[model samples]
Target: MSDDDATGDTATKPGDDRGATYASFVAIGDSFTEGLSDLAPDGTFRGWADLVAEHLAALTPGFRYANLAIRGKVLDQVLEEQVPSAVAMGPALISLCAGNNDLLRPNGDPDALAKRLAKGIRELRATGAEVLLFTGVDPRDSPVIRHARGRFATYYLHIRSLADLYGCRLVDLWSMQGLRDWRAWNPDRLHLNETGHRLVAAKVLTALDVPDAGEWHKTWPLPTAPTASRTENARWAREHLLPWLGRRLRGTSSGDGLPPKRPNLTEWP
Candidate 1:
């Protein structure tokens, strides 16, 4: 697939609400799954996974949800730490969205990452849990990392293929036209913002056949051109991008000792 649009949308058909109902769900991945930029009023992360869980809880009473995602976790960390624990929960549904952190690394190999992801997904599928997968956002529009667009595309294609092989429901984030807007992201220009999270949650519910998923997919107005101006670029480098590189150089991560936000499946209050 040469373009981002070419890969996804093959796994789960949109608007095909199969009336599926899951009693519980577990989301395992990196910061995206952990809801970094999408913060709650109380300053807690409440990203797309939480929103999807909310919709699922609405359908099934006493629906339990667990989020084992941590910030800055590479695929290996996710597989080694989060995946095993999520599998143990035995949730009826599992959403895996790791590998972005790995992709950001200079040595990141999409093919090798895909192989690891497939193993994790296969393990999740073996438990009779309906696995949810995702393709990353298209980086073509982001000036900061647009040069690596091909790398992200490679990962997206692999994710699409893996989803098909494992029969996992997929939320094709790269195909969502609404997220092309810069307003969908926070200042870091990496993680999705609250609006982006809302859109992603809608996509996830739609993939899972949640009844009210349609209400969240409204068309969004484009930003005044999300192009990175010189000033904006400088600010992003100082505030977000440079620090990320420093962490990589120092062999450290933001989630070095932090625990999962929702480590256990419990009724979401």
Candidate 2:
């Protein structure tokens, strides 16, 4: 399918009567925003942010976009490294998704993370851009991260509160049942797969009141077989889990030397 078809049929329509023409967009956060597991043919991640940008660009001429996100980045890194650049660009739309990495850590502090996130939102809003916030989906199907569901819930609630307080748009991933399915995830069972990213792009557009043809909340087909077996889980643990744990132990990150794929707010191709 074409990018327009995958994103939404109405995505190419001109801005609605509200005059919500997004001339530029900037996405800031971690691997989720960075598009991990949604690999392009060139081996780069073409995540929801990119898809959203493309959708908007098709509708608005001279629509520029930037994505300042890296994998395995905690909220602090995002606030410190990305927020400044995003503010400088001064895009009409900005989407921020962070704190999930921090929440995954032991003894994660939801309150503290929320405070930091709120500060960033406030700063972004000061720039007069429509800031978009996200609540991560529940990873109930993932044996490894499911344990942190309580923490995730706490953080998600806090995010909702911030969005309400700051008048920021919220993309409530937590309520998306489709994301809970293993089929939407990659081999690592962490990041969303290509289909998952497409759905997210559709949802984000919908949340922004951007015209789109695709439905983000559509139900997936029922599973024909049982979920992952013990043996399959074990293999996953060995391949994806152990390495992540090791990184935590050594205070290393998967995005150690990586740079944002689209750092500048250039016109979308």
TM-scores of the candidates in the order shown: 0.90, 0.91
RMSD, each candidate, Å? 4.7, 8.4
Lowest lDDT sum, 10 consecutive residues, model 2, at: 5-14
The alpha-carbon deviation from the true structure for residue 8 of candidate 1, after best TM-score superposition, in angstroms, is 24
Task: Residues 4-54, candidate 2: write the lDDT tens digits.
Answer: 212222222222344366999999999999999998888878989998998
| Regions more than 4 Å wrong, model 1 | 1-17, 215-218, 222-227
Which numbered prediction scores highest in lDDT against the true structure? 2
Candidate 1 residue pairs in backbone clash: none
Model 1 lDDT per residue over 107-183, tens place: 88887788777778777877878888999888898866788888889988988877776578888988787888777
Cα lDDT for residue 161, model 2?
70
Which candidate achieves the best TM-score against the true structure? 2
